[model samples]
Structures are given as C-alpha cells and as structure tokens.
Target: MTERVYYTSDALEMETDVVSCTRQEDGRFHVVLSATLFHPQGGGQPSDRGTINGVPLLQAIQDGHTLVHIMEGPVQPGKAHLLVDAEVRNLHTRYHSAGHIIGLAGEKFGWLGVKGNHKPGDGRIVFDALATPEPMTIEALATEIGALVQRSESRIITEAEGKRLVTWGTLKPYACGGTHVLNTAEIGDIRLIKMKEKKGQLSVQYELDA
Candidate 1:
C-alpha cells in the first residue's frame, strides 16, 4: 500500500521511491510510489493534477491498497520527486470542506445527508427529507450555512479508531477522506445557486467565490 502523505501533511511535494511502473494498454504508464502526496479521485473529490519527476501526471487512482499515478511518460523504477499543483489542491480542499459544512446545515434543518459531490465549480450535497416536517428553501439553507462559515470554526479531527472527521463549528462530525482546508473561513463567500427535489431527494447545488 502506498503511504498517503496527504493525510497527515498538506505538503504538495515529496521525494519517494518508485515501487513499480507498468505500461497500460492506453499507452500511459501506471506508476506506483512507496509514498505519495497525490490525492486519488474518490469520495466525490477529483484526482490531483501534478507531475512525477517532471512528467505530467495524467491521473491518480487507487487499486486496492496501492495508489497508481498515471503518467504521460514512463517513470523508472527508482527514486523520484512528486509535485502537486498548488492551485488545484487548494481549490479541491476548500470545496470538500464546504461540502461538510453544507452537510451540517442539512442536518440542522432536519434533512438527512445521503450523498455529496466536491468537484470544483460543480459542488453539491444531496439530502433525503422524506420525513421532513417543513420545506427548506435555498435562502434558509444559505443563512444557516453562511452562519457556520462566518464562525470560521471548522477542523479536521482524527479519532483514536482512525476515523477521519470533518467538523464545522460546533456541529457534529462527518466521516470524510477528501482533502480540506484547515478552517472553514478559507471557503469564502459560499452561494447556494440551485435547489431541486426529485423522488424524495433534495439536490442542493452550491458554489464558492474564493
């Protein structure tokens, strides 16, 4: 398994040994490193865009316990340097943290969070409110979430059991594996753009002006 350095530190670059390099059918090389700072595409967050040993990193994905970094050029099986795009990482971190805040807001309004997406420019959180006693408007939700953001009191807490939790202010924690900003204040000016209901599910779309 690749030691995921991003989980502990926000370092965008690292030097690690290339464990294996296999050429795929698509002609891209699947490179596995002993440790990596790249966050793979999972849990609604997109993959990190960067480079390995100066070669463009096309994609990063998890294969069981190991992370395979797809590269445009072949990387030799040896020590290599890994670097991630700071802007992309920052954008993803802020959006993912915002998702957690939106989830807390949903819970406050008696909505049950069922799904979420943290893709930049297209972030949203879905909730099931089949038993909700009252209708939730975008304005009300924005007010609630905006309040939390204004508090700027979010943190990433890891429990003894190794469960990663994202907490927004004093709200309850939500288990998450995606990258996030150190504080909710970094997610500036959140806007609830659209809300839709279908088949007992509420899709609340949002955007961040950072």
Candidate 2:
C-alpha cells in the first residue's frame, strides 16, 4: 500500500521509489509509488493534479489500500520525484474545510449532515431530518456558517479507531479522509448558492468567493 502523505502531511513535493509502471489498455501508464502526496479521486473529492518525474498525471485512483496513478507518459520503475499542483490543492482544501463549517452550522440547527460533496464550484452538504428540525431559513443557515468562518478557528485532526476525525474549534468532529486547510480563516468568504429540501433531505449548495 502506498503511504497516503496527503492524509497526514501538507507536503507538496517529495521523492519516492516508483514501485511499478505498466501501460493499460487505454494506452495510459498506471504508476504506483512507495508513497504519494496525490489525493486520489474519492470521497466526493477530485483527484490531485501534478507531475511525476516530469510525466503529466491524468488521474489518481484508489485501488484498495494502494493508489494507482494514471499518467500521460511512461515512468521507469526507480527513484522518482513528485510535485503536486499547489493551486488545485489549495482550492480543494479550502472548499473541503468550508464544507465542514456548513456541516457544523447545520448540526447546531438540529439538522444532521448525512452526505457532502466538497468539489470546487459545486460543493454542498446534505442533511437528513431524523426528526423535524428547528425551522431554519437559508439566510439564517448562511449567516450561521459565515459566523463560524469569521471565528477563524483552527482545524484539528485526530485519529479514533483508525479513522481520521476532523474538527473545527470545539464543535463536533467529522470522520473525513480528504485534505483540508489548517484554519477556517484560510477558507475565505463562503457564499451559499442554493438550498432545497426534497425527499426528507436538505441540500445546501455553496462556493467560496473568488
């Protein structure tokens, strides 16, 4: 299994051994590394974009405990260097962290967060009303999330039962595996785009200010 560097560290560049590189039927090479800084496309987050040994990466996917990297070019099985795209990483991290704030706000309002998609430009949190939640307007929820953001609280990451739990300030901790910013202030201004309730689920869509 490739060590998931993105899970525990914020390192953007690193050198590791290339375990294997094989051409697939699609004509792209599947590369495996001893360790990886690239976050694979999963858990509602997109794959990390970057280059490995100068070969452009097409996508990274999770294959059980290991991550398989698809690249546009061939990579020899040997020592290799990886460089993760800082811009893409920052955008995803900020959006993911902000999504947590939305979840925190929803929870405070008696809405239980059941699902979320933290993809940039199309992020949202889905909540299920186990019981009829306290009446909450879209504006009120947005204001609550904004207030949480303005607090500029630091993010805390810890492990429990081998699962990673992410918390913002003293609120509830979420079992998350994606990358995130160190602090809520780094998320910038969060704009609630839309909120709708259907089939006993409330979906709140949001984005960050450019």
lDDT values, one for every candidate: 0.86, 0.89
Error of 2 at 52 (Å): 0.5
lDDT, residue 2, candidate 1? 89
RMSD of 2: 1.1
lDDT of 2 by residue, 1-210 (tens): 898988889999999999999999989999999999999998878899999999999899988777899999999999999999999989988888888889889987789988889888899999998665888899999889888888877888999999999987876899999998888889998888899999888999999864
Error of 1 at 77 (Å): 1.2
In candidate 1, position 38 carries an lDDT of: 95
- The TM-score between candidate 2 and the true structure equals 0.96
lDDT tens digits, residue span 113-161, model 1: 7788889889989998746536678999999988888887857567556
**Top candidate (TM-score):** 2
Best by lDDT: 2
Clash numbers, per candidate: 0, 0
